[model samples]
Target: MHIPDGFLTTPVWATLDAIAIPAVAWTARRAQSELESPDDRRIPLLGVMGAFVFAAQMINFPVGLGTSGHLVGGTLLAITLGPAAAVVVMTAILILQALIFQDGGLVVLGANVLNMAVVGVLAGYLPYRLAGRGKARSAAIFLGGFCSVAASASLALAELLVSGVPMARQLLWFSAGLFLVSGVIEGAITAAATRAIEGMNPLWIREARPARPVTIAVAVLGAAGLLAAGIAVASSAPDALQALLPGSKNAGIPEGRLTKIVLGLAAMILLYAACVIAGRRIARQRSA
Candidate 1:
């Protein structure tokens, strides 16, 4: 779910932005290292995969009660492109959505990225790896996809509560009910996509590796910091949600049916080109 700007208090989003910047930088570095020897196929695959994810996120299914959920594609990307590359792809998608569509708030861009990209990918990938190979691997893919959405929703709910939204507990339960169903849809999509991709091109699915101890420690600490900051800031501010509502209003882009199709095609082409160039550069560097 893309959080609009006004849902989070200034302090909460600000602190998350700080944490998100460095986390993204780290992910980029990791991706560069991982893709240093990228095969010719991988560059195109990255672009196509990223574009696919971007397009998929635009289709929101009605979850009843006027609520809707779209495909996040974190686990799908991770399963295909590796976690680091998935993070980069997701970051690109989020940035484009924020800047071009105004789908998410620019001010809370960091938090949104952190919640969807970093946390979602890791939550999914870790479980998939732990489940191992064979029959369990298929189940793990479903579990990973389910967990990714659920975890993201949980964090978003926590953020809302910390922002002093009224009836936090009630809203949390309501949102959870919606996501429970949505998560199952995501899991099925992920499992099907994984199977199709594996059948067509096994190389696209990278084997999962355990993170080094230091990396794990840092991630844990970062997550803790985000949670603590949200709680601490929320406790101090009175009417935090009210204060944010004034400036949080979003005027989104309106496009015709043809325009939407054209724009989607253009986005896919642009992402593919960008990824190809980056992949080639990284490949050259390694060769040199």
Candidate 2:
């Protein structure tokens, strides 16, 4: 639910921007602390998880009523990385989506970031932190995914309403129902994905064991395939926010569909390279 420019009032976006800036800075420090470790594995783990979240957000499925839903990946990141690190990954994804794709708007970037990256990740992580290690771990994870999307979507809807997006009360309730359906789907996807990851490397999440290079490669490659397939299969349905703006979607994604796809691919490559470089730097610093 990336809020584009001109959708929000100046006050709404400005207030969120003010709150998001210091909040992100604080989270960055916390992420650094989470990454500070002798294991070295934690370094690459950060970027890999970021890529996972990035790719996950790309593939949207139809959820009916001229709207679509996609995996938000907040809880998954929180489960794999700590809440602080997850926030950092999500923040980077949102920023890149805004810049490279104009998938979101610059002026309102902070509002989107706060909704999806900060509160979304934290809201999802709360349940897991409470009951993840016990037998209720499965339920906790599902709820995490549910809460992640629910919280972000709820905030987006509320903000849009507050900013005078002009939805009838019925439409508002309809949007809420759509969001709830999406949240349930997200919960299921998250739980299944987490289970698959744990099956492959249980210690990766809990103990920070190094993920095999091959596993990461396969996952990234799979995501790439999905991205390609998504372009074809992804519904043309407007998302909840876009639905309100009627006839306002410009050129698939502000620069033609092909251009957006190419940039997305290129951005993924840059993310991988940046991660490798940063991971090496962190590793060296810790070693010395």
Candidate 3:
């Protein structure tokens, strides 16, 4: 879902970035405020969980068009972290993806972050909250996650359209039509991951900062070394190569993809390393 760099003109990217900068800052502040209650520990937990979600995204799912998409994991984070903080966690994930993995472009970072982080988390969590406590929890979790994925995909398509991308109708139709498919997959993945984490340490289920240093380290490494590689190759070769083979060129990258891949990976890798070290330190402190 990383809209490569250059997909949008300079003006659009610049405008979106300007808006994203403040929006992200506001989200962080909001998360901090939310942490003032009984779930202070959820702050670190959410951060680490965000990293884990990044790790899971490395496993790509084939969409059958010779192109594949990975899990966004927004709902999974929201289910565990709560709404406000979930945005912060996802913002971190998106930043790392755009910068280190080259999954998305820096110019379009704001749009991607807003769609995947803010919209997904808020939409997903609303259903979960409405479902209310206990036994209904899993059902709420699935629906919330499903809705989030659908909403994120729709919003992303809309952003692309508004940015003056050429394939507005096609892109929107492609994305929206896949909603049911994406929704089912997202729901199942979110449910499974949440259940696994909750089962591993029920305390995590109750909202405590993650204290697993090793898990944090592995997650960072996975995103940086493995997933980043996936993003790099996935965005570059297949689409571009296909474009060169007669009749396939029309479906190929829209000019600036190469640049987006380079810049995006560079940014994501740098951020991934920084986040890993920071997360490890936080994990160590929590364990101590």
TM-scores, one per candidate: 0.70, 0.67, 0.60
- The model with the greatest lDDT is 2
Q: List candidate 3 stretches off by more than 4 Å.
A: 9-15, 36-47, 59-70, 168-172, 206-288
Instruction: Tell me the lDDT of candidate 2.
Output: 0.72
Clashes of 2: 0
Q: What stretches of model 2 exceed 4 Å from their correct place?
A: 38-43, 58-69, 207-288
Please write out the lDDT profile of model 2 over residues 26-96, one tens digit for every residue. Answer: 88887777666756566677777778777777887666778776778898888877778888889998998
Error of 2 at 270 (Å): 48
Sort by TM-score, best first: what order?
1, 2, 3
lDDT of 2 at 3: 94
- Candidate 3 lDDT: 0.66
Q: Write the per-residue lDDT of candidate 1 for residues 1-288, one digit (tens) a residue.
A: 788899998877988799889999998888877865655545566677788987877877665689776677999888777788898888888898899988888888988898888888877776565453544678889988998888777677667666766654345457768778878878877887788888998987877543344434544554454445444434543244224334322435353444434544565556645744553443344334
lDDT (0-100) at residue 259 of candidate 3?
54
Worst 10 residues of 1 by lDDT: 240-249
Clashes of each: 0, 0, 9
User: Which scores better on lDDT, 1 or 3?
Assistant: 1
**Pairs of colliding residues, candidate 3:** 41-209, 99-267, 99-268, 100-267, 100-268, 100-269, 101-268, 102-264, 102-265
In order, candidate lDDTs are: 0.71, 0.72, 0.66
Candidate 2 to native Cα RMSD, angstroms: 18.0
Q: Please tell me which model should have the higher TM-score, number 2 or number 3.
A: 2
